[model samples]
Target: MRANKYEEVWTRIMFEKIEVLSNKTAITRTEMKQGVITLVKGLNAYFNKEISAQNDAEYINKVWNNFHLCEITMNLIGSLTPKELMEIFPIEKIYDGKKYQTKDWFSAHEAVQQLAQETPISESKEVFDFLWDYHNWDLHIFTVNVIASMNNINKMEKGRGLLEQFLEEQGVRTINKMDMIDVNWEEERDGE
Candidate 1:
């Protein structure tokens, strides 16, 4: 399949998984836990099949890296409370007695950085190191978007079109295009 088609399939699968979790009338901790496990297993199998079919080493490497990243991320999602998830993945920009910096919206990257720094000899630090090394900001945004949908912070759409639309918006487009431009979040936050 073409890249776009692959993305469509993946997005549909993700939406289906999230729907199963979110459609519950009163989701218990056990249900959430089982849902997360199922999600991880499903994703692992899907990506493994995709990875095995690839011929290019570079493409395989990219998918492999992404798979591990998603694995770690889903584990984190399962462990965190709704309140904590909300704090890390706020749907809109937030004010903290100052201007709204990009960092304040979907701040999981920053949170992970802080966690990695604060706990040098812990599993969080290890996970943070791996994520930082293969850091794809788009993935971070997508994960937060998923969490927001699951928690009813945002309504789940049918496919990846909404996410692509979001990424194409002016502000987000600029952020996604930048390399070193906005990497220094602390300076950006201070200047804002």
Candidate 2:
């Protein structure tokens, strides 16, 4: 299964860090930004093409897997607030025809519902059109992916100490649950 852009970016960042550490070299800010931009561009291009095709069974399956992966990630990190969502996917940029007004609300769900009601998909043909436009979509995806990558990196750093402690307690060099099943199967077969 393929990971969402966030995870993909996070993995790329981690690998970059490892390379820097091994080489004892520092990465420039511009270099990091350029790398991220490249990755975002590539991902956006691939997703846009797949989404446009829409009828490819393999792409559809990948999309479903990506959806589930994103759902799990969101569950772990908690949902973004309505305000945050708006910041990432600004209504002004998305739809230029009519301004859709939204009010502040205590509940994120209610706020999202109000926003949805204000900008119904049926009324916003331009929304789909804008999304289909590669240049616009690429820029939007780049911004979102960058934000998600930073957020994931922060969260992973925060949890790193605990993960290390857990590994120490477990007395294992690495935790590979999938390999454990294979090991068990081999032992069972030997016994049989």
The number of the candidate with the highest lDDT is 1
Steric clash pairs (candidate 1): none
Find the candidate with the highest TM-score and give its number.
1
The whole-model C-alpha lDDT of candidate 2 against the native structure comes to 0.40
- Badly placed stretches (over 4 Å) of model 1 are 1-16, 51-192
Q: What tens digits encode model 2's per-residue C-alpha lDDT throughout 96-176?
A: 222443222222233344433433322433232223221234445643543344444443455434444456468644344
lDDT per residue, candidate 1, 1-192, as tens digits?
A: 585566566656655766776677776655554554445444533443433434566654554455454654455553545334334433343434125443443354355545533222234544333332322344344454334333321222333344445655534553334532347779889999
Q: lDDT scores for all predictions?
A: 0.46, 0.40
RMSD in Å for all candidates: 15.7, 18.5
Model 2 worst lDDT run, 10 consecutive residues: 126-135
- The estimated TM-scores of all candidates read 0.26, 0.24
